[model samples]
Target: MGLLIGVGVLVLIALYFIGIYNSLVRARNEARNGWSQIDVQLKRRHDLIPNLVETVKGYAAHEKETLEAVIQARSAAVGAKTPGEAGKAEGMLGMALGNLFALSERYPDLKANENFLSLQEELSATENRIGFARQAYNDAATIYNNKREVFPANLISGGFEKAELFEIEIAAEREVPKVEF
Candidate 1:
């Protein structure tokens, strides 16, 4: 009777560990999927940039520096391999795009052009999607990190490494400037 009781307790412990391990795996996969959603949106944004640049180029040929900066930022963003690298590159690209739009104000015709306006709108929507995806990714990462740090799970989580959040390091850029009319 003593041996049977010990075996039953051991089985329960094994099942508990398995359950925790599975939960961790699911959380990690959710985080990865969230990042993938961001990647899809980013790629869409990248694909639209060349068209945007070309449209602006037709009107603002003299703005070589701004156009080149946008192109270079786009390239860096597309080449980014990790989440941290991608976030930084994406921030730079956002700044470059902002400069390009600000320059567009000088060209009334470019602003009026239907193709340019359509592309700009599409890019804006994609940026929104990217924001949502980043939030989801961070949420997933937080859940996994918490699970890994919590009591019983922490004891078993030694075999698993903590997942990294898709964090943007560009604090200054993320802030909105106070614009008082």
Candidate 2:
């Protein structure tokens, strides 16, 4: 009878560990899926850039420097493979895009162009999606990290590494702009 009881207890312990292992795997997969969502939104934003730039180019032919900067920034952003690299490249792209838009302000015709307006709206929507995806990814990563660090799971999490948060390294991006009525 004692032999049977010992075997039963061992089986329960093995089951408990297996449960924890499975939960960790799910959390890791969720974090990865969150990142892929961000990537998709980023791709949409990238696709809109050339059209926006081309529309601006027709109106502001002399603004070659700003146009080239936007193109270069877009290339860097597209080439980024990891979250860390993407964050840095995206910051540059954002600044380049800001410059391009400011250049458009100088040319009333560019600002009024229907294609430019449409592309700008689409890019803005994509940026919003990217922001939401980043939030979701960071939340998932935090949850996974917590699961891996907690006592019971940490014992089982020997194989699991902490997931990286998609962090913005740019000080400007982190700062909130003031709005006054």
Q: Which clashing pairs does model 2 show?
A: none
lDDT, candidates in the order shown: 0.81, 0.79
Candidate 1 lDDT score at position 78: 93
Q: Once superposed on the true structure, which residue ranges of model 1 sit more than 4 Å away at CA?
A: 81-87, 166-181
lDDT of 2 by residue, 36-91 (tens): 89889878878888888778878987888999988998999999988678778888
Off by over 4 Å in 2: 81-85, 169-181
- Would you give me the overall lDDT of model 1? 0.81
TM-score of each: 0.83, 0.86
lDDT at residue 111 of model 2 (Cα atoms): 75
Cα lDDT over the full model 2: 0.79
In candidate 1, what are the lDDT values of residues 1-181, reduced to their tens digit? 9999999999999999999989988887887788788778889889989999999989999999999999999999899998678778878988888788877878899989999888877777776676787888899889989988998998878877887775644542232111100
